[model samples]
Target: MLYEGFESRESFDLLTVLKAFIRLLQKSPSSRIINVYGEMNEYDSDMKSWTKLFRDYSAKFELDKLMDQFYEEFTNTNIKISSAILGNDNNIQTIVEEADRIVHLAILPFNSSPKSKTMRILYGIVGEGMGRATRSKVTLEILLKEQHHVKVVVSNRAYKFLHDNFSKRFPSCDEASEGEAAIDIIKIEGLTMQYVNNVFDEKASVLHTMQRMPDMLNKNLDAYYKNLVSWMPQAVISDFDSFAYIFAKIHGLPILSIDNQHIVQRYVIPEEARESNPIAFYTYKCFVKAKLPRCNTIAVPPILRQSILDAKPLPVEHCEYFLVYQSSKSDTSLISVLQAFGEKCIIYELGREEKVDNLKFKDFSEHGFVDDLACAKGVFDNGGLSLMNEEVSLQRPFLSVPVENQYEQVLNAW
Candidate 1:
């Protein structure tokens, strides 16, 4: 069966395995696919922000929900999509007792904060693009090619959103109202908002999405080994999220670390601007341990590297300068530094969206980092693995401001 989880790498990895499982199913006449997930609606606050962005931004362009809509119309075959939430008291022992292959997929959320000095702008894009959207189609294609009897176990919320919307779009499939066509979707019984709240709420944001990560992974891994200990289908694929990394480590599952961006952008103050004291160094180390290790370890483009380098141009050009600070918390510090250099500054804090009296501190709820970054004269934020890597690749001359403790590592890396 194919299993899919959405959250972090551990949460979303089942989707990767499901992709392979689907291919195997096509070859086997009567094989089945089973997909599973935690609660979808009960997401980390960052996840909420991202979801809102997707819904709102896409709606404005009338292009949101295109992927699910497109997939339904493209395929015609027997498939069933079902879901069940895994409750608090739910026993993993009960589910995997049958001894079949189990796949898991999880999608984790990254918070929108410049405090994460190691996180680059590219990191966000890659995390959201592949970790969320691409996996859906990749898994679906795998199943169709494999022709396995597909069973998809998902959270009630995910199923409601994905399945219902799918059927509504493609009503002519073999089993339109929900018969098996292309792939089967089954919901796990106990996953609820309460459960997810408890799972991802350790921190105010979802970057702590890995809080319940260890336990959740151990539970799922144990169940998989107990039931299909020997057969161990093809491989377990996971992203760079720690849960995925841990799963691959503990179960000896071959890890497939998928990601697009490489570097995490930390700060983007113009050359004439002054630098402020960033966050602590230990925080930077924690990110590497908790976040970077989980990814497939991809590099960002080269352009960003050049952009960052260019931003800190030497020999003081004394050119008419504008200081645009994207980060809310760092603006005061940036201005202090710029004024020390005797440079003209225009500081823009991203809490509001419009131009206000010489200073711009707009609420960026309607605007995401990508939008903000595009408008930045020189971007300043955390150097996330994804952002830094992509910037380097793109050859953008951005600057990197390491957190207090992480300077050594960042310097060495740059």
Candidate 2:
């Protein structure tokens, strides 16, 4: 039995884990998959929609009233979904006690620590950028392939993303399989940075998140403690997630930190490069040190899809058009800037769903973006480590606009 936690607010982070879990399930045909989640209100609007669909489908079929009949009708299918709201401590405890292993997303929780001997593995990720999530995906694939049971906990948009992908990847499973595992998805509140006109607004973001902390802590802590006590995990594998780092320390579990963020902390900067932005670099390094816990092992995973790794980069002059990636729908400034380049060169903008004359806008996609990037003349995006890594790997001319007050992005850009 396995309890997977996907408690992230960022969709990319959740997608990373979701893809890994789906691949794991597909490879391990005999494995039983159980997914657990929290209250519907905790999720963002998109995730709420999915939950509603699940509820509506259940209600329409009257599955609650006729579970036996429904099971009989869909007996040949491999996937089965059953949802319950944990309104009290008893319900939470019951689920925790039944699961043999836990897989958690890397965001840190506010609850106090507990002792446990269960084989628990965690994959934590930063909530702000997709780089951490991208790296975590590769790591999770490796972990699941090794057959280690884990509980994943994430929050924000990531939770919804992983939930949707899992549904799509494994629509059904074998009902008669004996070695079935339960996958639980627990959603909790995570900090999301506020933005003003596509630029990071640090003060407002902090205040906004701080305002919600009281209620988030009160509700999640109660459930967190109960679950930890019942399902004592043996180890944690974090990808720059603070909660898992703290939990590992409190419980004395061996933690392996795998992410590119650590490169700032552990890498040796050259003498000349260190002089470029001493204050910003020092401050950023300090912040990372404070957030991450000391781990038994620290590894920096590469952030690239198989397509990117396999393809050859075209020369700058030969490559046509500029590739742009931005997550916000409200930011029109970047569009205005790109328009200045004129209709002579095409601007391929990812993360925007529509197309506008000279600019070809497309929605954010892992495979699609890589294909575009492979043939682009230049790349323009916010200073996200994932994209930056790809830019460097492909040797593409790049321009990055780091979000104000997000020092990590600033440092990465530097």
Tens digit per residue, CA lDDT, model 2, 226-320: 34423445687766777767777766678777666666778786655466667767876887788884544445456575566887878878886
307-342: candidate 1 lDDT, tens digit per residue: 333343322233333334331242336544555655
Runs in model 2 lying further than 4 Å from the true structure: 1-119, 166-185, 226-228, 270-279, 296-301, 310-318, 327-332, 343-351
What is the lDDT, from 0 to 100, of the residue 52 in candidate 2?
55
Predicted structure 1, TM vs. truth: 0.35
TM-scores for the candidates: 0.35, 0.63
- Listed per candidate, the RMSD to the true structure in angstroms reads 17.3, 14.4
Among all candidates shown, the one with the greatest lDDT: 2
Model 1 scores what on Cα lDDT?
0.34
lDDT for position 149 in model 1? 27
What value does the lDDT take at residue 363 in candidate 2? Answer: 58
Which is the leading candidate under TM-score? 2
After best superposition, candidate 1 residue 291: deviation in angstroms?
A: 7.8
